[model samples]
Target: MRKFQNRSKLSQYLSEQRTKVSSIGFVPTMGALHIGHLSLVSKALSENDFVVVSVFVNPTQFDNKDDLVKYPRTLEKDIRLLKTLSENRIAVYAPTVEDIYENKVVSKSFSFNGLEHQMEGAFRDGHFDGVGTIVKRLFEIVKPDTAYFGEKDFQQLQIIKKLVELYHLPVKVIGCPIHRAEDGLALSSRNTRLTEAHREVAPFIYKTLNTAKVMFGTKSAQKVTAWVEKQFKKQPLLKVEYFIIADIETLKPVKRKSTKKSYRAFIAVYAGDIRLIDNIALN
Candidate 1:
């Protein structure tokens, strides 16, 4: 697999490829390549002539310095996995912090007034802005015909959609389904940090959402949230950060209404010091 660090070299490589009219699919990641990330890479490989995966652990996305410090970095293992997945056809671009953002000058900030400030955004200030800036930068660097993002980070996906619309970018943004474990826990790099007991109990978040969806069919929104909160609260290993039955688009807590619409059951939990998020949709 070919690798390029600086933009000039990447641009030069892409320019040569463009002459041949090759369609590129991009998967941008904060390199701790879990199955969730590889799922996107797999999708890209299936649909495009060429695939480029950028592995840069973006510092701006983390609100907590300690979290950033402790964030997993498995570059050698990640590269080995990617090589095996690609079967020698994938190109990897693992850039240094200096190479990606030398001066730290953010081009423009994306502001989704209501959507950015709720749930995950409420807890981590400027988290989506960090997400937006880094993603936008990657879009500029990769300049792929299509970009893939996993739906595990639902809010981040929404924000990226908005960013593309607002900026009138040429690339297509696609959201892939969340990959999960056999037991239903959402696949995440953070999952590696969970203790055995917490890992055993973590699937309850999905179970709670499943129950909430069934209850929402006949019950009020308040009842659903209450029940979900109660179930999560019962888990000694899981501490619920925020639990809400929200409108899927707005991410705002929903109230009972006569006409049915879409809803999302979302949760962020702190199992010891590691934070994990998962959600399910109810229609």
Candidate 2:
């Protein structure tokens, strides 16, 4: 696997590669590698002639400076993990912040339309703007035929779909399934920060979502939401940030039960100091 820190060199090399290869698959991520990341890489390796995985910890995405500062940086370990996957050569673009955001440090306003008004977009102000900027930038640089993203960030996935549509980018945005631990906790880079006991309790987020899923079959949306909040409160260590039952297409909260439309349950929680989020289908 060849590693490139410079975006220019990587882009130039890929430009030449475009002539030789039929298609290129891209998996863009923040540095701390996990099973979830590898799953995306696995799909990319299977589908395309060449694959490029980027591990740049984007500062613009985080609203809080401390969160960005404290975010995991396991570059050597991340590379070691990625090496286990690709049988053929894979390009690992671990670019510096300057390489990605030379003049543009802050995100310019992006219209994800009203999709940006709720969920993680609502809670984390300018979060999706940072997401849009970085992703659009990477898409331009990599110039891949297809890009892979995990559905753990469901809202972000939807927004990127919008980003491609708005700009008329040729890249295909393939939403891969959210990978989970054997116990059902969604695999995350942030899982590294959890203390031993908290790690054990983390799967409760998924457990709660699954429970809500079954409850939604008989109960009203409001009732299921209240039940979710009450259930989380029972665990002293876990605190519910927001438990939303919404339409999958529009992402607007759906209060009434309807047979015609598909629904989903999304949750964000604070497990001690670390915040975790998970979602499940209500159908």
Candidate 3:
């Protein structure tokens, strides 16, 4: 696999590639690659002629500077893992911050249209704006026919889909399933920072969502949410950020209703200062 650090070279390469290829699939990520990322790359490979995976830990996405500093950067190991995948189908774009954005100039001011003021957005503060801007920039640079995103960050997937619709971008937003570890914990690079105890407790986040799902199966939405909140309260280690049963697409809170349609149970918890996110369907 050829690596290009220079923005001009990479842009020229993709432009030239655009002339030869009928379609391109892009997976933009903040590196420290994991099974979840590979899952995205794999999906891209299946659907498009060229699969491009970007591994730039976007500074704009991080609300706190320390979080960005603590974020993993296993480039060597990541490249090795990517190499094991179909080499001809994959390309790595690891550009510096300047390559993506001009010196001191950034894309910060974003209007999420009320979607940014709830759940992850409300808590993270400008998190979705950072996410939206960076994603828009990436879409502009790559200009792929399709882009892949994991549902682990469910809200992010929602926001990107909205961004595409609002802007009328000529790219398809494909939401891939959230990959999980053998023990049921959602595969996340942040999980690497967890201690054994934290990791053990991490799966409970998924378990709690499952619990909510089961309760939703029998009980009303109000009761299900109350029970889930109580469960999170019981687990002192798992500092629950926000747990809600909402419409999967609009993300608006759903009232107690009898329907076998799509509903989502989103969660955010702090496992010893390392915040982790996971969501499950409550159908």
Candidate 4:
């Protein structure tokens, strides 16, 4: 696989590829590559003639300075994993923070129709703005025909789709299904930070979401939310930050399920200092 750290060189390479290929796919990541990230890249390779996987850990997205400092960085190991996918078709752009932001590393303001003010937004202030900033910058840099994102970041995925619409960008943003472990915990880069005991109990997060999905059939959204909170309260190790069943589109917490609208259960749990988030669809 071709590797690039300089934005200019990567741009030149992509420009050349554009002439030879009909379509280009892009997958933006923060390094520390895992099977979940590879799943997105694998899908990108299947649909496009060429794929570009960026391995830059964006700084503006972190609301907490300590979290940013603690975030994993494994560029060497990440490239090795990507190599196993495809050598000729994949290009890894592992740029430095300076390469992405030039001088000032700051986030730009974006109106996601209040989508940003719920759930994660409620807790991590300006988190989505940073997400918007880095993603927008990368989109401008890569300029791919299509971009792939995992549904694991369901809210971010929606915001990115909105961003493309607001800017009238030609790129297609596709949200792939959430990749999970054998135990049902949604795969996340932060999973590596989980302590051995916490990791064993981590699967409970998904187990509760699955139970909430089944509960939706007979219970109100508010009741289900209460039940989820209660379930977490019983577990001392895992702290529930926020759990809500909201409309799949607006992301506003819903009181009851409707036949015309779809809903999803989103949860954020703290296993010690490591925070993990997961969501499940409820029909």
Top candidate, metric TM-score: 4
Order the candidate numbers by lDDT, best to worst.
4, 2, 3, 1
Looking at candidate 1, the ten consecutive residues that score lowest on lDDT are 104-113
lDDT of 1 by residue, 154-245 (tens): 88888888889888889899999999999899999888878898899888888788888888889988888778778877788899998887
Candidate 2 global lDDT: 0.89
Which scores greater on lDDT, model 2 or model 3? 2
Which model is ahead, 1 or 2, in terms of TM-score? 2
Q: Of 2 and 4, which scores higher on lDDT?
A: 4
lDDT of 3 by residue, 73-185 (tens): 98878888988887676778898888888787454776666677668877887788889888998888878899999999988988999899889999999999999998789
Q: Any runs in candidate 4 off by more than 4 Å, and if so which?
A: none
> What is the C-alpha lDDT profile of model 2 across 1-283, one tens digit per residue?
7889999999999988888999999999997999899999989989999999999988888987888998999988888898899735579999998998897688878997788888998789899989999999999999989999998888888899999999999999999999999999998888888988889888889988998998888999999989989888888878888999988888999968789999988899888778888888878
- Output the better candidate (1/4) by TM-score: 4
What TM-score does model 2 achieve against the real structure?
0.97
Instruction: Kindly report which residue stretches of model 1 are placed more than 4 angstroms away from their true locations once superposed.
Output: 105-108, 258-260
Model 3: residues with Cα > 4 Å off, grouped in runs? 258-261
What is the TM-score of each predicted model, taking all chains together? 0.95, 0.97, 0.95, 0.99
List CA RMSD, all candidates: 1.6, 1.1, 1.5, 0.7
> Can you rank all candidates by TM-score, best first?
4, 2, 3, 1
Clash pairs (backbone) in predicted model 3: none
Q: Could you give candidate 4's per-residue lDDT for residues 59-103 as a string of tens digits? A: 899988999899999988998999899989999999999999999
